[model samples]
Target: MIDDSIRPQLGIIGGLGPLASADFYFKLTRITQAFRDNEHVPAVILSVPQLPDRTEAILAGHDGPLAPLKAAVSTLNALGVACVAMPCNTAHHWYDQLAANSRAEIIHIGDAVVAETRRSLERGRVAVLATQGTLVSGFYQDRMSAAGFELCLPANTEFQACVDSAISLVKAGSIVDAAVETERALDIAQATGADAALLGCTELSVVAASLNDVNGLLVIDSNAALARACLTRLGFGTQEARGLPTVSRPPGHDWPMRGSLAVLA
Candidate 1:
């Protein structure tokens, strides 16, 4: 049985790009479904927006991201957070090092997103829209494929541009533009004839509702999936009730769409 007094505190190592970090925290709160004020989960957010660009570091090799990541871990650990979660998909490539030096439990956002996608969707063609680093790492494709799903992707150049635009918009605080970039990514995924598009980036959730034109395509929002997972871990919402509040279904809704991270692998 879980001990209420010993509930673990959640630590967020954010600013992997600032917007994603904020979105993850917001979703975590919104999905908690706390019946009493004291039931709220404790969270420690370290938003160091100056950290090395995760995608840039991965593509360009270890050109100095270790320091910031390590610092993030240190800050959260000092704050007594028992588990840490990073919202960026690309950052997961360096997760081993981040976890190696910390006693805090680290949650793999990318893996969580993929696992939820598998459980919610039938094993079939899945396309992931993310930064070049994430694609290059084969993080989503490799993990999903290992689970018996055929992972599809956009044309090389198109995928790169999508990643670039999403990051650029999010950093600029142009959330509406971020949503547009997500739609563009979905288009690229559809062009590849994918059954669905996995929004492998956390920023997409910040403006997920702004995307209203994704007709006949399933869109998976990883950040939202993570929120649900966090809530489930805290015993807040049930399996079916653990996600974004329901609204009027947009037109032509055929597949599932959640704004939380889904555990993939």
Candidate 2:
């Protein structure tokens, strides 16, 4: 249990895709090595799915997401959180800006995933599965390459299309189609001779689960990695929290889609 006097508070600048933000919170709570309520990390989540599409802005060379992302960080800072974490992988393209605006430490999902991969494997080809924005940003590619690991990108444009489809399906509340498309993307990554596949997008983490990896491929969940990193950074128990980074929903509440609230309309 953490002492009340110095218990570090966390803020989640979520809703990059909505469910991904909810999923990140669920992972953070579920994986915590807690015996009771006080053992878990205290967090506040600002789930505003109203933010502009990060991928669109990135690919088109627009700075549309910068204002809202920085605003979210400022809000969290005003709320007095000690650290902030955004689950979206592509949004890390604006990480430098977000970090610059925040009074708290903003945890980069890409950095957490890359560091987790380095810890899990000595040196190997890493297949990165992410949004086109993330790929175009070169945040993961540059960092991973500099870390001395070979990278296995999508086999072709079609592979990334499948990933994009999967991410969209999940956001639209189409879980089955999302899983099928996610499986397709994973299958393509597996054949790239890579030792492990990184689910670098938080949307991809929505359907992350145990699979029968015939080739013994290692799969890393970026959202879970970031959640775990948050735990470690906040002085929470993590060493013996959970076994695997399984897809978990925290209890009764369903994660709402982008415009799920009829009352708001």
Number of the top-ranking candidate, with lDDT as the measure: 2
Worst 10 residues of 2 by lDDT: 256-265
Off by over 4 Å in 2: 1-8, 210-214, 239-265
Q: Can you write out model 2's per-residue Cα lDDT over 26-104, one digit (the tens) per residue?
A: 7888878887988888788888899899999998999998998888888888777899998999989989878877779
Q: Flag clash pairs in model 2.
A: none
- Per-prediction TM-score: 0.82, 0.86
Candidate 1, residue 50: lDDT? 81
Taken over the whole model, the C-alpha lDDT of each candidate is 0.71, 0.79
How many clashes show up in model 1? 18
